[model samples]
Target: MPLALYLLAVAVFAMGTSEFMLAGLLPDIAAALDVSLGTAGLLTSAFAAGMVVGAPLMAALSRRWPARTCLLGFVLLFAGAHVVGALTASFAVLLITRITAALANAGFLAVALTVAATLVPTDRKGRAVAVLLSGTTVAMIAGVPAGAALGVLLGWRAPFWAIALLCLPAAVGVTKVVPNPAGDGPGQGRRPSLRSEFAQLTNPGLVLTMLVGALVNGASFATITYVAPVVISTAGMGELWVPIVLLLFGFGSFIGVAVAGRLSDRHPEAVIGVGGPLLLLGWVAMASVATEPAALVLSVFVQGALSFGVGSTLIARVLYQAAGAPTMGGSYATAALNIGAAGGPAIAAASLGAHAGALGPVWASSLLTAVAMVIALPSLRVIAPGAGEATR
Candidate 1:
């Protein structure tokens, strides 16, 4: 809606790209660094770990600073980490750099959500958040693939260099476009106490909303983390086609977010009431028809769609329920999502390790989504009926 929101989206795009591009570059990184694939993959784990811790910590630390200043500072830190990552030859150095970048990315995203909500009308907070998160969908559709191609053409480090370059303009844009709103200035009212921030979690509605967000995200990533292998072994597709299928998933995610943005404004609960079941069904469909190429393609698309479709509403719900602690709300949402991102894959991997077939992840993800739906059903009654429309 506002230019500042768009600039926030740009910052998100750069951060999202960094977060996912590593998935496509793991093989190259493993080989280049003379490490096992599993070790290189830990880089992703490190990043997720950083995000799980950094979001609330940064939010607490920056409580007295202007949102614009926190955003700019975090982006600069992220960019500097990317530069270090790009130059590092040792795997240990790269791992540390990725963690640092993730911490900055987490802080940037948490602040961006709060800032985006502030920039819009109460009725439009969902759409505003959707606009900000669309950057991640766009990154999935374009940035990851492009970074993979860049890695293929040059080296795994090239993508980091590109990410570093991308952050420069985002940092400048935030400084120039985003406002330092009243009450966010330095020496404003007393900083939010740790006890007060944690009190937000005492709200059953907010807590349930966070759990649902985590479960939904965990289910999605459970399948996505191992999609290439699942497609190849189960669908009988060649390796080259994996990227195309992933592209379809990304495209579906983009559409899902666009639609969710509108629906969340009108019927936020429906995101879970309807979209959650759809997500579970999508996963079940994939598990049932994993060997059929057509079915696999359709299932992936549907899974991606429903996985993301409910995301905007989840954020809106948290914002509504935790209105008094908006910054903490944003941070908590980010942390919950990252927790799922990390946990989902671990569960999927364990299922596979237990001799489950290529469809193991599909089954695992379905169970998680079903749990999310069960959680969502009761939580809807806990949130104030009109809370979605109330601005704190």
Candidate 2:
């Protein structure tokens, strides 16, 4: 609700765009760099690896720094990395840039989550997080598509420049709007030591909650990583229809996140329990209808809504369970989410490599969602009692 939160969302938009736009640019990059498509794809994996490693490492190292300072520094660093990436001719240099940018992005997100919680009351934390994550949905709807268009029309390097430029305004806004005093959490500026903060990892509830987050997100990326190809080959759609289907999914995700923000605070159980099973059903339906244009299109929207709704709710649950660690709590969520981002697509790729049909990713998504539900629904009692009720 605060201006700071919106500014944080804007910053996240640039980061999300950089992260997701590559799926559409890999071919151009591969050709330009004189490498195989598989090697160019490693750029994406590098970013995820940086996110997973940098989340906790950067969060812990920057714990003593002012929150606003950390955010500003990371934003500038990310923008600078993009500039270097755009100028580079060597694939190795571009790879380093992706890693550097992802580290900055990860650190920024970790601090931003903690800062968002401190900006609002305990009851509104879920909504605050939703507002922050909506940036990603918007990126899916507009940024990735636009980046692809730019790459096609202006060259693959154009989107990199655009991403760098996009961050400038967000960097300026972060300097102006985000309060400098909110370093990590409230109090006399007392900072917890690494030993004490890392101790939160020992909590079974928090660990399970993180695992739930990873599994749910893995399910999401599993399908989404392959959605474009599925839409083209399976649904018999033209290139124009690819972005249309993706736009529908993104719009559905926006609506889903809005609902999650409203309900997750008090009724996390309902949000996850109902949404998780429905998401699994959506994936099953998606696989069955993959060859049907109308049915597949409709299923994508429903799948997006259900997948993000449950995934966002699980993030709120992880943050709550890791509340004792404040800044590190965001790192926990970030690592879990990125772990899924990396692993899910790898699984889907393997399935496709095994000569599974165009629908392989959909079935992979279903299995992952089922695994997530099996892990999550039964342990809701231990991992996520309603916020309004007592925690076990």
Regions of model 1 farther than 4 Å from truth = 185-192, 383-392
Off by over 4 Å in 2: 182-188, 390-392
Q: Tell me model 2's lDDT, rounded to 2 decimals.
A: 0.88
Name the lDDT value of residue 346 in candidate 1: 91
lDDT (Cα atoms) of all candidates against the true structure = 0.83, 0.88
Output the worst ten-in-a-row residue range by lDDT, candidate 2: 182-191
Can you list the residue pairs that collide in candidate 2? none
Alpha-carbon TM-score of each model against the true structure: 0.96, 0.96
How close to the true structure is residue 221 of candidate 2, measured as C-alpha lDDT?
A: 91
Candidate 2 local lDDT, residue 46: 96
Best-performing candidate as measured by TM-score: 2
Model 1, 134-194: lDDT tens per residue?
9998898899899999999999989999999999999899989988877852212344666
lDDT tens digits, residue span 1-392, model 2: 89999999999999999999998999999999999999999999999899999999989888877888889999999999999999999999999999999999999999888888778887877888899999888898889999999999999999999999999999999999988763343211566767988999999999998998898899899888888779998889988888899889998888899899999888888888888889988899999888899998899898888888988888878788887887688888888888888899889887786566777888898999899889888898876687765232
What residue pairs are clashing in model 1? none
